[model samples]
Target: MEFKLNLTQEQKLIMTQQMQLSVKLLQMSNFEIQTYIEKELQENPVLDAEYKKNDNDKAQDEIDYKKLIKHLEFDNYGHSSYHRDDEEVSPFNFISAKKSLKEFLKEQIIDLNETDYIKSMCEYIVENINQRGYLGTSIEDIAEELTISQELSQRCLEIVQSLEPTGIGARDIKECLKIQLIEKDLKDENIFKIVDEYLELLAENKYNVIAKKLKITVQKAQEYGDIIKTLEPKPSRGFYTGEETKYIVPEAYIKKIDGEYHIIMNDGTIPKLNINGLYKKIINNEDDKQTVKFVKEKLNSAVFLIKSINQRENTIYNILEKILEIQKDYFEFGDEYLKPMTLKEIADNLEIHESTVSRAIREKYIHTDKGTIKIKDLFTTGISRVDSIEDVSTKIIKKEIQEVINNEDKKKPLSDQKICQLLKEKNIDISRRTIAKYREEMGIKSSSKRKRF
Candidate 1:
């Protein structure tokens, strides 16, 4: 009954389809973008992948370099700029997708010379093993859950423990280490004893007490502790876990050129997108109205996608460049030299919104001459320095705390307050409570827990 029209002045920030596309492109990692481009190539009739000789050569060089970098980090790694005949090189060789750990274990289980019933039980137990290679359930609980005897469950667990990687199906860290030790067939019984009874003490650096109890020298105990440190704590570390584990491809690399750091973005993976000439021709002919409209729509989408991807690349490049400039010391030296930076600071410097910077960096990573690091890792909240006018990074303060605690007398471990005093003396203005928080964050034990003979 009442049809009234009222005019009110209102302003709203609305995201258009193009803007949404741009944001999505910005948020996606390099791997994600490659996948997205592949999908777009399949779905969009007007979109085409352009691969020229120059691009092909450049991409090949980058891939070789990438392999070299991988080799440095892991085993069987090498890179060569040497070009071979194009016919000899297979494109499929570039595919580097890894098999998941569950799949890897399942294949071994299939080949196991055991009864089907027991194999099924083993499979069930394998399912219960978490990503960190620790059994998620107790043998009793698993037996009860499966309505089986504890004996059968225990046998299956032993079989799982016997599998490769040497430490799979371990219920805890102690079991994991012990499994590895037995697999190696270490002649020393004292190491087994230490794992069995004194893991907590061992972690606290109580080697002297361990040596005295085991009738061994303190030096030997220290050596055993060092050996334990070398064991693979996570059995599935080198291999893929599952979808939960993100395979990171660095978006860019910071290479120091003549003492100046330069960014080398991994854009080789991204297909150079182009409009299909046939589609453009179809539009240019202007024959059928319906055909023209359809082609125009698809062409608009293709153009928008190309524009959005370009914008995304530019935004990420700008943010990373700013970060490199700000974190020059960290790029040059190491993690301890990192300056506390905020998203807001980078956004301000780049003349963009803080949220824009955050979105651009979500799931993004950069490779440095030092090491590969997440873009977010460069940002930390700063704390004021007592004597110096400059603020100190909480990361730096944590490093300082760790260094002091490391060099302190083990029998008389520095308390949080004492650590705070030591930091203050070094001009890091931080409270005792904050120090404790940072220490806990770094997984350092409390003073009492850290004390040893």
Candidate 2:
């Protein structure tokens, strides 16, 4: 074969800065959009804020309630409720906002006249708490991070565990319970023996085996077990200041109206902005060529920015439209109706790149009558086997394990193998190791640790 010059017609896609800007805007949250606008205003002298003419504008606008009501599409569920009252309070209690576990622990550490280094280590340990109040990191990991000795890290960890929630800095459930047991200094003489020797059996609620091995009565072992349950599992949870907690402001709202789902963009909360009239006038006015050129360039840039914002809004609307179409059942029924979806699926459906779909949904949300949900939540990884009745997400699996463990007879809790077998019977097809992992993720102890009288 001889080489020949040949050209073929093919689709070519290139990501330009304009396209990038549009994507960036699409992915930005409402707060982020405001910040971007503010930054643009500062940098571009031509972009200026349009202030309301105060009471005069309001008084004249009173005649037309439409001016007061932002342009929100009213659905059959009643006109999209817009609060004109500036005094509308947040649903969350502002005054009694709980302190984060890290800050609360830090406050206690401040009273200790230790060196800054030790204080810092304590803070790090507190910050790494898992949901159930375990440190979730090894001493070696902490030492490596801080470039400090493991001994020092352990010391700080010990101090943190000594705080109000007894097991705050434990590495695992066993350790967490052990710390609590050590703190309480209970009369259960065989507590340590039981924890070590029968933790796995205990985890399965194998109280009969535990009592037989420890030579203790079932009632006594249960008494000790009950004491362990009273300890705080997660010490660091619920510690955000009201002001610091970022609320999810949805970009769109989906409502069920007349036995049908309807979608609306939530542009009501965002403030409206336009090109500054003064700058537009200057651009239009005749001036020196250099001045005119500079003004025109800046004006073009501003227009591009506005166009990007508009494109971002349109892309979000289109993506939401597709999601509503695909997940119509979920909106109507609830989570159980959510079919497994992936980024690739949406990309294929919309004829957009996968990354574009990812960017479109990133940090974006849809407010439903149920609540504000992140767009990402709509896409779930499908389970390997499609025959299972249970939801395929690991979270759902973990929850089931937790529920099983929670209700297990203290004398006979399920073992990892048994849990795996049970899940298999239910078509979950999880291995014993996977069961163990789910158990750990749920902050559950092993069958031995779970053993009671």
Candidate 3:
């Protein structure tokens, strides 16, 4: 094979700075895009915001959401109602009302005890408690700072435990329940003994064994377990700060119009922006040299920006069309039908760079009957399963594990190894580590935690 040096008259377009700017603009959300346009208008005098009048211009812009929705709707089986109008849309309630016990402790410090020293000690104690609401610090450690006796610290702690929800300042689970039982006036010698001596058995759901050892009836043991369940194991949870409750506004809407999906930018909520015509007229005047130079610079920047904005829109539409082509299954079916995909897959399919695909989906969302899902959520790595089909996702694997556990015999619950074998038999060949991973992901406790007698 020999290389040919002869040149062909091929006119390949080079990627320009304007195109880069356009990509960046396309990645921006509606609010960000509006702000960008506003900034350009302020800086560029040559780029007038005024509407350019023409004879062929339409009188008004028409936006039809319903027609667009019809196009986005997936092919029907002739009589199915999966896209029913009355399906209750669960609006994301972003404002979380979690309150951890630390905050509860701080609040009570103000009203519970008037002594500044006691309040300071209590604050220190609250700060040292773990997420499970157990006091991680020692009474001796708290006593050192307040110049108080350990006895005083213990007394204050007892008061703290008595505060609310039955168990606020417990050092351990046993202590947490003991306090709760005392608060309910149900703390007996047997209850205290069970808390101190049978806690390990109690946690393992060995209620029968515990009852036999303690010479109590099985019903009595279960009644005690029920009381334990009612006690707040995580006493500090009442003061949890809900900083994670951030709201997101979708940048675009995908509607089905007559069985076709149409992408619509959420630009209507923002004010229409354009370069000022009067400003442009002032710069174009022939008499003023300084004004002309200043105006020319601004005018050039504005024109570049306007062209960039239009380019941005076109590029976004192109990328979204590609997304639709690949994720059509997701839009048509519910989340369960979503196939495993990734940015790299889309980029390779579209013959574009991965970064470009990533930028396109960043902070962007497609609003539909399914809800405002992040555009990026459509792409997920495939899970290695028995079916030659690369359709499984980690989410689905986790769900399968949960379903298995839910149906497992309570008396002989499946262990991690057992669960892995079950999954292998089902074609989802997951390792023990993967089984543990899915178990942890679902917030399901270990067999030990799930143990019930």
Which model scores highest in lDDT?
A: 1
Residue 20 in candidate 1, Cα distance off native in Å: 1.4
Give the least accurate 10-residue stretch of model 3, judged by summed lDDT: 86-95
* TM-scores of all predicted structures: 0.69, 0.59, 0.58
Error of 2 at 314 (Å): 1.6
lDDT tens per residue, model 2, 1-453:
898999899998898887778777877987688788888888877665553355545644444346333323344323333344433222131246566666777899888878987888888887787656777789999999999988988888888888866777788767777787788776566877776667776556666776787888887777666666576656544555224667788888898888888788776545556677776666667856677788777787788887777777887888888888987877887765677678898889888889888987887888897798889978876444438464475645666688778888866778999887776766776778878876887678887767555
Model 1, poorest ten-residue lDDT window?
Answer: 74-83
lDDT score, candidate 3, position 205? 68
User: For model 1, what is the alpha-carbon lDDT of residue 404?
Assistant: 96
Q: What is candidate 1's lDDT per residue for 210-232, written digit by digit as tens?
A: 88999999878888887887888
Ranking by lDDT: 1, 2, 3
TM-score of 2: 0.59
Q: Is candidate 1 or candidate 3 better by TM-score?
A: 1
lDDT of each: 0.84, 0.73, 0.72
Error of 3 at 383 (Å): 3.1
lDDT of 3 by residue, 54-105 (tens): 3223311232336435534646534433232434211122224566556666
